[model samples]
Target: MLILGGTGDATVLAVRASEIPGVDVITALAGRTRQPTVLSENTRIGGFGGVAGLTNYLREQQIDLLIDATHPFAAQISFNAAAAAATTGILHLMLIRPAWNPTTGDRWIDVESNQAAATVLPGLAQRIFLTIGRQELAPFAHLQAPSLDTRNKSLLASQAIDLWFLIRMIDPPPPDVAIPPGKILLARGPFSLEEERSLLQQYEIGAIVSKNSGGDATYAKIRAARELMIPVVMIQRPSVPSGEQVETLETAVAWIRKQLAIRA
Candidate 1:
């Protein structure tokens, strides 16, 4: 079995799958983070080039089942996995955590994409807590205070909210990337509500920008926002290819067992 993995649930599934008798599990990592959580199963890092490269790998390895346990926003890899499975005539399944929904007292402004979220930020608040990962930070960089002599006055005025961003990510951003005026917090998640509240207070965050990457690990921030009555600019997830998807690890494990049993 080949599992395309990156999320915490993926790690759980990988560990569970490794324990099953006669199942050969291999987990693939995207290598985005500097130090990824180590998986007990055999692991491969980096991309497979593209769809063609992935298809070639599936054939060469003679994989029986392919499980896409990638991040929900990792649409390209998910699509490639589906296409590669189709080409190889192997069974494919997607294991994804469901997207988050807003409850009462939650001030969430949903936007189609990161760019749209950036466009909406200045109107919402001046002090922003940007929780979206480092890769997507470029879109919001324009929110930084511009030079006084700049000519585009209207553009400057519209963007001139003088936003201050607080970026939180596990890895430090590359030096060449242009980032908004902000302090970066280098940390991993499963963060506590107290810690999140402290962060919001420390930064005096008026608004928060985050992707709807649903799971409990980073959810404290959302709860903190709700408690503080802070508005959140949520970037909606991209659509992924349709397939047999299981939301829970038990169901995924059962599905894998069924496939392995049939093959056995």
Candidate 2:
């Protein structure tokens, strides 16, 4: 079995699936980070080109099952995985976690893309807490204080928006990339509620911009934002290729067992 993995769910699935008797599990990462958490000794890092390269890898490795456990926003790779599985005629599964939804007292403005989020920021708040990872910083790069000559605009547009962003990411983006105008906070997830609240308070964050990736690892920020009454600009997940998907780890395990049984 080959697991396209990078998220926490992917890591857990890799470890659990490897423990199944008589099964060989290999996890592949996109190699976006300098030191990604090693899944096991059989892990391979880097891309598999595209659909063709992935199809070749599946054939050469004699992989019977292909599991996509990538991040919810990793749409392109998910589509590639689906295509490669179709070409190679292998059992494929997508382990997609549910997206987060707004609840009571949560000020959520759902947007379609990062570009939309950037467009709405001027109307939302001045100090923004940007929690989207390092890859998609280009959309927010042009955010800056508006010039004084634009007095004809409405209050939301004429507020002299000194756009300050608190950009948080696990790793710093490539140096050549143009990031938004603000301080970058380098950190990882599973943050405590207190830590998230303190960070928000310390930075005086009036609004937050996040992807609805939906998992407990980073949900603390959402909880903190609710308590602080801070508005959130939530970017919805991008569409992925349709496929047989299971939400929980147990179901994925059961499907694997059934496939292995058929092979046996």
Candidate 3:
């Protein structure tokens, strides 16, 4: 089995399925993160060059099945998985975590993309806590970065482009990136309630921003903000093309087992 594992659920699923009686599990990680993890029995880091590299890996490794449990925003890799599955005649499954839905007392501001989220920043609140992950932040920076070169007035209609951002990503944000001063927090979470509380007080955070990466690991911040009556700005998960997507580790394991049983 070949598991494209990077997201927390993907990592859990890959690690759990490694114990199957006759199955050999190989997990490919995006390797954007440098932290240590309890991954599967066999692991390879970094991208597989695109569709061609991925297809070659599938064929060379004799992978019988492929599972795409990547981050919700990893569109290109997901596309590669779809195409490779078709080309190699191997089974594929996508494990997508359920997106967070609205509930009472949740001050949710929905945006189409990260860029849209950036645009919404001015009026919503200036002192914000952003949890939209490292790579997805590019859209916001692109919209916000000031350059003297040419006119890109299309994105400047609102003039709300001057809003400040306090970004907190898993890894240290890119130094080369153009972010406003005194606005970057280098940290990872499952942020503790106390920690979140402290941050809210320290930063005087009026708004919280996040993606619906549903799980206990990183939810404390949201809870803290809610208690403090801070508004939360959320970016909804991107839609994945139609597929059999199981969310939990248990279900993912069961689905893989059923596929193996059917093959037998």
Candidate 4:
């Protein structure tokens, strides 16, 4: 059995799966997170190359079942896995966490991409707390670079740099942003309100950027920003690729049990 791992729910499900006798489980992580949770059984870190590579691996490993338990934002890998499963004829199940709904007093600015958020940034405010993923950081390169008009005036105007981004992510982003050293903050979250408040205060943050990755792990920052009356540059969850999705562990367990019984 193969399970895509990293999500909190996925880890919980993996632990439960490890309990089943005679069922070998292999969980794959995206290798994005620094302090990832330990799986219930054998674990593998890093990418699968692509669909072709995964297809070949599936045949060689003779994997019987595939469980996609990756984060909601892990779209490309999820798509690749789906393609590999279809070709290899491996039984596949998706265990996706549900998305979050907006609550009262939440000032949300829904954006489609990192660039979109950047476009609105100048109007929103100068100081920003960016929390989009590591891989997604490259798109913000232009923001990191100074404008042509500003560069001609003086080095001090460049030095002043009204627009600032306080970026936070799990893994190291590709070296492309070229942002000033003082601007970046490499940290993981499940951030406490106190921590969030302190960070925002220290940075003098007027806005926050986050993806609506539904979970409790990184939501305290949003609440902290809210208390500080800072706006959140929110990106909604992307639609799931074509698949049968299971939300809760109960359903996933039942589904897996049925599959195992059928195999038996």
Candidate 5:
């Protein structure tokens, strides 16, 4: 079985799948992070080029089942996996955690994309906590104070905002990319509510910007925002290729076992 992995659920699924008798599991990581959590003994890192490359890899590996246990926002890989499975005549399943729905006291301003979130920031609070991943930081860079140049004064003046961001990520962003003026917190998630609340209070965060990548590992900040009555600018997940999907890990494991049993 070939499992496309990165998220916490993916890691757990990889470990569980490895224990099943006669099942040889190989997990693939996109290698976006500087240091990713080790999933299994048989793991491949980096991209497979594109759809063509992925289809070739699937054929060469003799993979029986393709389980897309990737991040919800990883639409490209999910789409490629579906296409590749169809081309190679293999079974494909998507194991995704359900998205977080708003409850009472939760203020969520949903947007289609990161660019839209950035565009709407000025109208919200000035002090923002940007929990969106490092790769998506470019859009919010415009919120930074304008550069001092006479020739570009008009453009700069138009783009200028009083907003200050607190960008948090597991790794530092790429060197060449420009970012908004704020402190960067480098840490991994599965954070406690106390820690999340303290961090928000310390930074005096007025609003939060995050992707709707649902799971418990990084959900403390969302709860903290709710408790603090802070509005969240949520960037919605991108559309992926349609397929059989399971919301829980157990269901995914059962589905895999059923497939393997049929083949056996």
Candidate 6:
């Protein structure tokens, strides 16, 4: 089995799935982070080009099953995995975690893309906490703060008040990457609620921009935002490939076992 993995759920799934007696789990990471947590000795890093490359890999590896447990926002890879699995005549499963929903006290403004999030940000707040991943920061880089002119007609210009981004990611982005004006915090989660609250309070964060990459690992920020009453400019997840997808780790493992049993 080839597991398209990068998210924490993928790691957990790899470990659980490998325990199935006859299953051989090979987890693949995209190598986005400087130092990704090693899943196992069978883990492979880097991309497989695209659909063609991945299809070729599936054929060469003799993989009977392909499981995509990548980040929710990894639309391209998910689509590629689906296409490759179909081309190779292999069973494919998407172990995508469910997206987060707004609850009581949550102030979430849903947007289709990061660019849409950027468009709505100025009206929301000045000091922004950007929980979106490092790779997705380009849209917010040129965000200009609202300015008050003599006539009070807000003008959009780079010279206007600055729009600050508190960019947080597991690893620092490459030197060449263009990020918004802000401080970069390199850390991994599940961050504790206390820590999340402190970080938001410390920065006096007025708004948070986050991808709806659902899971408990980073949900503390959302919870903290709710408590603090800070609005979150939530970027809705991209369209995933149409196929069989299970939301829980248990269900995925069960499906793998069932498939193996049927084959046996």
Question: What are the clash counts of all predictions, listed in order?
Answer: 0, 0, 1, 0, 0, 0
Q: What lDDT score belongs to each candidate, Candidate 1 first? A: 0.89, 0.91, 0.76, 0.79, 0.90, 0.90
Better of 1 and 3 by TM-score: 1
User: lDDT tens string, model 1, 106-172?
Assistant: 9999999988999988767878999888887888887744324356433454334557899999999
Worst window of 10 by summed lDDT in candidate 4: 153-162
Off by over 4 Å in 4: 33-41, 141-161, 180-182
Model 4 residue 102 CA deviation (Å) reads 1.2
lDDT of 4 by residue, 163-253 (tens): 6778787666666645423366677657888998899999898888888887788888888877878888888776667878888888998
State in Å the error of residue 186, model 4: 2.8
lDDT at residue 112 of model 3 (Cα atoms):
72
Estimate, for each residue in 60-113, the C-alpha lDDT of model 5 and write its tens digit. 999999999999999999999999999998899999899988899999999999
Lowest-lDDT window of 10 residues in candidate 1?
145-154
* Cα deviation of 187, candidate 6, in Å: 0.9
Which residues of candidate 5, in runs, are more than 4 Å off? 144-161
Q: Could you tell me how far off, in angstroms, the CA of residue 84 lies in candidate 3 after the best superposition?
A: 1.1
Each candidate structure's TM-score, on Cα atoms with residue i matched to residue i, is 0.93, 0.94, 0.86, 0.85, 0.93, 0.94
> Candidates sorted by lDDT, descending order?
2, 6, 5, 1, 4, 3
The runs of at least 3 residues in candidate 3 whose Cα sits more than 4 Å from the true structure, single-residue gaps closed, are: 36-38, 136-164
Residue 231 alpha-carbon offset, candidate 2, angstroms: 0.6
Candidates 2 and 4 compared by TM-score, better number: 2
